[model samples]
Target: MTKIARRTEKLTEALRRAGVRITRQRAALLSVLAEAEDHPEAIELHRRAEAVVPGISLSTVYRSLTELENQGVILRHQFDGTPARFEHTETRHHDHMIDVDTGEVVEFASERIEALQAEIAEALGYEIVHHRFELYVRKKDGL
Candidate 1:
């Protein structure tokens, strides 16, 4: 199967495990979610899903997203001053940089930053369990 198909199947299975029936509309939403690269808000997701299969309500989108999130198949990011956005949990560990002006999110991973966080946690007599790091940035004037 293609990557998107595999991801959709995985999402479908997750929702099924969460006791959510996979209706045509919900399946469309799952397919859209699986194909998403950038974090998208619920309304954006609803719009996309509606294009694939009309008549999908925004409230249904929200409920399906909540169910997917609860099933640990997706992650929601509430960046400063923006509506909550979501991405599938299959992505590798990474931090985010949110463009303050454009509301764009960029993902990056750094071993140095991870190690530094671990060191800081150890110095405070604690072990790093889970953490989220985000940076708000704007484009340089000339760049």
Candidate 2:
């Protein structure tokens, strides 16, 4: 199966396991979530899903997202001064940089930063369990 199909199936199975009935509208939303490459808010997701299958309510989208999040199949990011956005949990570990002017999210991974965080945690007499790091940035004047 294609990657999108696999992701869609994984999401479907997760919802099923969580006892959510796979309504047609919910299926469309799942497909949209699976194909999403950028973090999108619930309203954006609802709009996309509505394009595929009309009559999907915003409340339905919110409820479905809550169910999926509870199932641990997705991660929600509430960046500063923006609505909550979501991405699937299949992505590898990475930190985010949010553009202050455009609300764009950029993902990056750094071994050096990871090591430094670990060292700091050790010095503090604690082991790193889970963490989230975000940087708010703006474009340079000449860029």
Candidate 3:
């Protein structure tokens, strides 16, 4: 199955396990987030969801997203001092580089950095469960 299909199935199962009834609004919300090419704030998600699901209340969007996040089907991050942004959790693990000026997030993975983190954690006799490393960088314009 495709990643999107797999995610949809996982999300449905998560909702069932959480005892949250899956409704049209909730399904639309999950679909928007699952197909998000970039991390999107709740408002942006609300807009897209509304486009696909008319009369879907903002509160419903918020509630549905909260449930999805709680179930670990989505990942939330806050950079640029803005409201939390959401991304599908089924994608490959990658660190983020945020452009401070433009408020863009670029995903990157560094094997060297990952190895160094493992070495440091081992030296400290701690096994890492999870870690968040965000790089805030600026691009030089050829002005």
Candidate 4:
């Protein structure tokens, strides 16, 4: 099986374990999220999925997405009320730098930030399971 197929399988199993019935709607939602390159909002996801399975209600997309996120099949990040965006959680961990002017998200990582977060979490007696660090920035002098 391909990587995408494997991911879909894992998501299916997760839903079953969570006692959530695996429906066509759920499967379609997961597929859309897995195939998405750019993180997308709920409405955007719904629109895309609708193209595949016409007449799939927006509510179905929203519910399935929320449930999938709750089950850790996907991770959600909120940036400045543009609707929470989602990315598949089976991928690597990285930070994000959002271009405020273009509304584009760029994934990046900093060892310094990662180390600091580890230290802080340890000091607080909490092992960090996950963290999201996003810097909303723009070109100051034109890049």
Candidate 5:
């Protein structure tokens, strides 16, 4: 199965396990989130979801996001004081770098940074339960 199909299935199963009814509206929103390439705020998601199934309201999108997040099928991040963006959970861990000027997001990973985070947490006497990192950036002077 494709990535989209796999995510759709994950969301469906998670909802079922959580005892949340799988309505067509919820399923449609999950599918959109699953297939999305970049992190999209609620408005962007609502727009796309409406395109997929006409007449769906923004409120429905909000509720579905909240529920999916609670169910652990999605990850939501608020980067550099911007609106919250959502992504389907991925097995591999990564962090986001945001272009402040153009509002673009890029995913990146660094073992050195991960090790530093662990060291900091250990120094603080806290087992890193969970953490997320985001950096605001700008394009260079030239391409």
Candidate 6:
């Protein structure tokens, strides 16, 4: 199934669904994003895209990312004070645990936590239409 997805769902197709026009530069940016596992900020994403599409500019990357986000093809997260990072929307839904010391992001999901959040929201006399959870963490000594 994953292999089929990799073969079928190019980022450009996603952009089209979001009403974005496809260009060579845009395709290159999407290619980089499709291969990325970790969240990457604009500069980092541009750097990676450069390898595939020479002469890609920083401004173009920013524009492409913004378009992708607006199209609902990508999701953004800001960890600590760092520049925002982006991930593809089709990936599994989960919360992020950032190792602030290393800037590493670990994705995790918990049914119990989800339930608790819903309960808390209801207790507060509101329902959760949408939410984001991110936990900043540090490694313990002699782990």
Per-residue lDDT tens digits of candidate 6, residues 5-60? 56226557766776777777777777778778888889999998898889888988
- Model 2: clashing residue pairs? none
The local distance difference test score of each candidate is 0.94, 0.96, 0.84, 0.82, 0.85, 0.82
Question: Residue 75, candidate 3: how far off, in angstroms?
Answer: 1.1
Q: How accurate is candidate 2 locally (lDDT)?
A: 0.96
Q: Lowest summed lDDT over 10 consecutive residues: which window, candidate 3?
A: 26-35
Clashes of 5: 0
Residue 76, candidate 4: C-alpha displacement in angstroms: 1.0
- lDDT digits (tens) for residues 35-128 of candidate 5: 8989999999888877888777788788778878898878888887789998878757998899999999999999999999999989999788
- Model 2 CA deviation exceeding 4 Å by range: none
Residue 40, candidate 2: how far off, in angstroms?
0.2
Q: Candidate 4: which stretches are off by over 4 Å?
A: 116-130, 140-142
Candidate 4 positional error at 78, Å: 0.7
lDDT of 3 by residue, 1-143 (tens): 87777777887787777788878877887777767889898989889988988877888777777777899888889886868988888777789999888889999999999999999999999987999889998998873
Candidate 1 lands at a TM-score of: 0.97
Better of 4 and 5 by TM-score: 5
- Candidate 4: deviation at residue 124, Å? 9.6
Clash-forming residue pairs, model 6 = none
- Please name the candidate that would achieve the greatest lDDT relative to the true structure: 2
Residue-by-residue lDDT tens digits, candidate 1, 59-111:
88999899889989899999997899999898899999999989999999999
Q: lDDT of model 4 at residue 119? A: 95
How many clashes does each candidate structure show, in the order listed?
0, 0, 0, 0, 0, 0
How far out, in Å, is residue 7 in model 5? 0.6
Candidate closest to the true structure, highest TM-score: 2
Q: Give the runs in model 1 whose Cα sits over 4 Å from its true position.
A: none
Instruction: Please give the ranking of all candidate structures by TM-score, highest first, separated by commas.
Output: 2, 1, 5, 3, 6, 4
